[model samples]
Target: MSNERAKILIVDDDAMNRVVLSDLLSDEYDIIEAKDGDEAIGILETTAKDITLVLLDMIMPGRDGLGVLEVMNEKGWIKGTPVVMISAETSTPQVERAFSLGVTDFIYRPFDQMVVQNRVRNTIGLYLKQMQLSELVTDKIYERTRNSDMLISILSHIVEFRNGESGQHVLHIKKITDILLRALLKRTKEYKITEEEIGTIATASSMHDIGKITIPDEILNKPGKLTKEEFDIMKQHSMNGAKMLDAIQFFKNEPLMKFAYDICRWHHERWDGRGYPDGLKGDEIPISAQVVSVADVYDALTSERCYKKAFSHEKALEMIRNNECGVFNPLLLECLGDVADTLPKELNDQRTSKLSDADFEKIARSIFESTENDTENIIYEQYLTEHKKSQFFASLQHGVTFEYTYEPSMLKLHARNAKALSFPTTMAEPENNSEFWTIFGRENWDEFAKLLHDPQLNNDSFSFNSEMLVKGKKCPCKIKVQQCWNRRDPENPELISVYGCVEFFK
Candidate 1:
């Protein structure tokens, strides 16, 4: 059914019957006519997918409404398309059969126009509402799944980046786990895994080693076997990973969170029960944990570690099959074997696709610098906007506004309101702070210089009436100045600039 109008099929042997219904509904719906049950069946067989409602006259010359209803049921069109039985016959048996055969409503000959219109409107509204609700649910599921995936991707990258592993480590685990899960689903009915659950397992597998972020680099990348105490500290990552996710209030009771937490905290647990962080034997381990544990082990074996070179794909599979890593679910092991030949190809592709550390760092830094620059540009733009507004307002005041750079000893006259305060704009200003002071009376210049240099008065500013010398003539003037501090290195205590307004003291 379209958002504009629903499609309605009007079926009757008599032309007048079809004409009456079409006249009533053609304004609100698209009307298609079938003169008999056979014609209706032909239309339904060809176009039933889009047809929203069927108006079937019960008593027809041949293959009447009951027969059409039976055909619709057999064709499985009854679920999506609702049917209404039109009857001139007042018989009870035919109407009962029509209802049992899934007629949505019934209308008699000499139809009440209002009753017919209301029933058709209500039936279409109900179906549309149900369809809309189903679509809303599907969209919500997709949005939640996407958000979950993005969150895991970001967090897993942090772990892999900190651990100095290739960025593809998590990706490889996810791929292997997906292959293993699908193979398991096909090989046996023992695991009641659905397509949705398979996706969850694959996504959660990427976070199996997320706890490694908490492990110190020295211990994590040690080239030799860890000391017992160091190994204990290393093992805490699983619990640490779980605790980290648990702290996120939004993930509370979310199934993905549970799957991720289980994978993180228990991927190390073994079938025979010799693993760390609460070892559970056999099926006591979560299915998600079991699947990811296998994926993590395969990747670890085939990936280069500080302590050992990467094993060959064949050797890695052989080691797992031989239970060299630890005991695993026999069912999963069988599934792994079924797909083992393809695993090397998948892993080879991942390895070939891996970004070098230098390349990864360069790319990561580019992204960070771009974002930082964008933020800084926005702040600088806002500062300029406010500064312009302040300058505009300051321009309206009756004085000469100037900004002085302390280090370079340059003065920029922003506005001049009096002839007594005139300075030559084309001429170079004073070359340094000492030369700048020569424009004022010696005693007043010395006092102002002391104020500029005072540590305690670094940010504090003052305004006073003083005698200023212009063209070697002393005149009373008032000045206000405030020091500007360097924002980048605040502790350096270098005065960056000073802004002031000056006018005649009278």
Candidate 2:
């Protein structure tokens, strides 16, 4: 591997410096030369493959190294390319600016060959190490992604399998979300969301209701009325969904997990603060939550559930229109109008449940006939909102089962669920011993220990024992504390972790 030639791009107007530097490192690397920043960018604009490390000079005539960096940032052609600033200008401000613009490291003028090689090697190695760590993390995430995708597919299947909605509810929601989010991007000039990000977000959105795994199939598939308490318990699904997402932190930045977490937690929240568990109102909710809210409600209203028949797109729009300012974001409601007719058609909502005025009133009348009626419903009178809770719950009744929540926390996971799940219990000894941890982890032991020591084992009950952790048999890799060895695999690369164990090739 050491014999492998690293590709180095040299961008400089200085012939002498380039010659000297190239002569020193050319044997160890395949040196690519560009006289100026514009030329360097032009080279990169075409087939500049495998060009890893860039030794960039600060001052050039037409477009300097800084200008090249600016172009690179704009194009975003490369993800984590390392550019080291090689310059005569060693002033504090200039060096600071270079570092600020994401330069990997700096090498000054009158630089020694040994020092230059060391800095170049250090930066390249570090950059390579970061790339490897990212790959490993990505590999771990990809494995989790595959697992999540299967789990979500199963949940989605459960919804359609029993409820008879086509196996495409989630697929449609994913598509609609993509369309609207892209439209919003175009309209609002929002952040640059990549295709990968969108794909992952859509995929993750599919599993937002996987917490229904914990819900009983009877209540989930029931074609009848759930008592108020049962309905409240049903609400816990959202929290359950969020809890499921939090359990596998390996998928943190994966868009689907993020979308799933948001939808699972806040899908039930009202635009007004009247929503349950956490009475989050309006924009205080996550934008992903808001987007899914619009998508989810629109799908549910137009599709049949067990308790009621589906409203036609026109009626669905009317309901949304009635909702106007309070229930749905008025702007999003307006956006809904743009896609209204085509959406159901696109989603292939062939089993559209036809409903009469009686059916509407059957749903609408629940609040009116019940003693729970207060000024709140009367205030939103024109809206005629039956139940945000019911809408979510009835989704299951229609076989549109999604994951849900009992409460949302400051971090967005349901604190009740996290606190409940995070509680540790002692693992029973198994012959293999690994199975004990494989099933129930050291976390469980720590929690049990905490509870043993303290009557109340709260979230903050256990202080992390760094030394004990280091000495543990699991020997889980901690590459950051020392250094990382890069792996070439993009999908699932192994990260070579260097521990703090003191050793050398003596």
Candidate 3:
């Protein structure tokens, strides 16, 4: 009797009584009835799909309503299903007991027809409201959880950067997690996953190592086998991380939260249950932990720890596969094997090397040079060259082309091949366009620089971030790249190419 329509199940011994309920409610709700409490339990166990509410008789032959209530509580689905008890057995004790077992309401028999209709309608309305509120709360919490995960990742990168450890750890974990999550779904199809779910999972995975927050920096960066006590403290990070994530309600039931929880809680659990915290046996441990267990250990093994030199990737894989640590789900171990075959030497090499102050200084240098070149040929007579006042103007004649190659992983820009790249900040946001990124281009850009260096004829340096562009298009005179110096190029500088102009540097 369950469908898109509202479904209500009634359990009462009296046949004529069932007839009365069926006639009154059947028009608006899909209804099911059982002759006794035992039969009612049977129907619920067999086909309770999509049931919204239960109008249960409190007393019946064989099994009583309370007994059925106990079963529903065990099923865990009762939290989502509403139950209202109805019977002649509405003495104080019976009423008290039904409520204790989670019945939503109690109505004694010899009921008023109008009262019954009103109570049922009101109960469903309240149920609907609670469900809606729960969803809203869940969504809010999930967003916070996702943000928390992102925050953890950023913080972790900062820590690694301080230690001269580049973002190799973060990138490695992300790629490995993606592979494992996909492989598991393909193998078992345990849950229905969508693109959005994958996104949250990835975001939340950022916190898998959040427990490391509690570990002392010395021990964390020691790069060797942790002493027994130090290792013990380190082990607690998974538990600590899980607790941190658990504090947020949205993450309490989310898929990514589940993944994070596993990472934080069970990543240390052993296949043989000898690992630590709580040694859950293989398959007994959470699947998330099992997948990451392999990944974390693998990354740690291959990374250059202060205590231990980085192991060769080949050696690392061989050790994990050859050993019986039982750290990974056997299926995941095989998947890792497939990925290992293609893992690059470059990935290993990038374990160190992050942008430093020196790097930023070089960018500043370029800015200075670009500025100096513009004043070289500026006819102070034609225009008042407020040398510093004309900051946005590009010295195209001496403007040196900046060619930048971005490391797809770190997200920092390097510049070359473009003269006078400048980025100016705007206090006022764009009024009509969300396409502000258009300074780079609205269409196909193979690399980020193409778009950033791309010009927008509509806007000027004062209008937006002109930090990455030349002053303007080629001048009407078509001056040669070497012809001018110490002068701010006119509205149009000489064009070597559509995006090219002469430049100078300090």
Model 3, position 30, has a per-residue lDDT of: 89
Q: What local lDDT does model 2 show for residue 197?
A: 65
For all predicted structures, in order, the TM-scores are 0.58, 0.44, 0.39
Write down the TM-score for model 2: 0.44
Q: lDDT tens digits, residues 1-506, model 1?
A: 42767899999998988888888888899999999999999999989988989998998887988998999999999988999888878778877888999988888888788888999999889887888898999999886665565556555666665454655788898899899999988988776778888887888887888778667655675556999999999999999888766655444678778888889899999999998799899888988899889999998898876567889888999999999999999999999999987887876676412233343333333222334465434333323322332433334456666555554455655322323456532112454345446656568867776787787877666677787667767778787767666545556766766666777665
Cα RMSDs, all models: 18.7, 22.4, 18.5
Give me the overall lDDT of model 3.
Answer: 0.57
lDDT of 3 at 142: 82
Stretches > 4 Å off in candidate 3 = 1-3, 154-506
Ranking by lDDT: 1, 2, 3
Clashes of each: 0, 10, 41
State the lDDT of candidate 3 residue by residue for 406-441, as single tens digits: 211111111222212442221123222343344333
Per-candidate Cα lDDT values, in order, are 0.75, 0.59, 0.57
Candidate no. 3 TM-score: 0.39
Which regions in candidate 1 have their CA more than 4 angstroms from the true location? 1-9, 22-52, 58-81, 88-103, 178-196, 217-230, 321-323, 329-335, 346-506
Per-residue error for 466 in candidate 2, Å, reads 71
